[model samples]
Target: MKSVLAHPISQEMDSVAFEDVIVTFTWEERPLQGPSWRNPHKDVIQQILRNLSYIENQWRDQHIENQYKKILSDI
Candidate 1:
């Protein structure tokens, strides 16, 4: 499905000077924290873990794709 951002500040530089930026954002109206993140329930903790794993896999895939493109361009 197609997706869109909820905020306009897409890049760090988009903010004005010395603006507090939200590094971790969500499309939902509220952040996904159902309870205390430090002592969250099992389900909340699992969601956090899943998000972390997804981010890691995305980073790995992007890194590999960039390397592949660089190699192809250099050839």
Candidate 2:
């Protein structure tokens, strides 16, 4: 399959502000206790935001290709 990072939508993601990204992530009703058995906590969500910050830094540095490579490799 083609890489999502290479998609046109990713270009729009690159333009979005960091604050907007955080707002988007936190806006939804994320249940503390899930439909699944595991209970998720605020810190888990916060950690995701932290990881996103790292990716955002790379995106801001215009290392788009390298970002894709890193993401794909992680998967």
Minimal lDDT window, size 10, model 1: 15-24
How many residue-pair clashes does candidate 2 contain?
Answer: 0
Best by TM-score: 1
Q: Model 2 off-target regions past 4 Å? A: 1-40, 63-75
- Candidate 1 lDDT over 15-74, as tens digits, reads 355346424446693467655663555676699799999999999999999999999999
Residue 43 in model 1: lDDT: 79
What C-alpha lDDT does candidate 2 achieve relative to the native structure?
0.68
Cα lDDT for residue 10, candidate 1: 48
Residue range 11-72, candidate 2, lDDT tens digits: 34345765775533343555543756333556677888999999999787778777888999
RMSD of 1: 11.2
lDDT of 2 at 25: 34
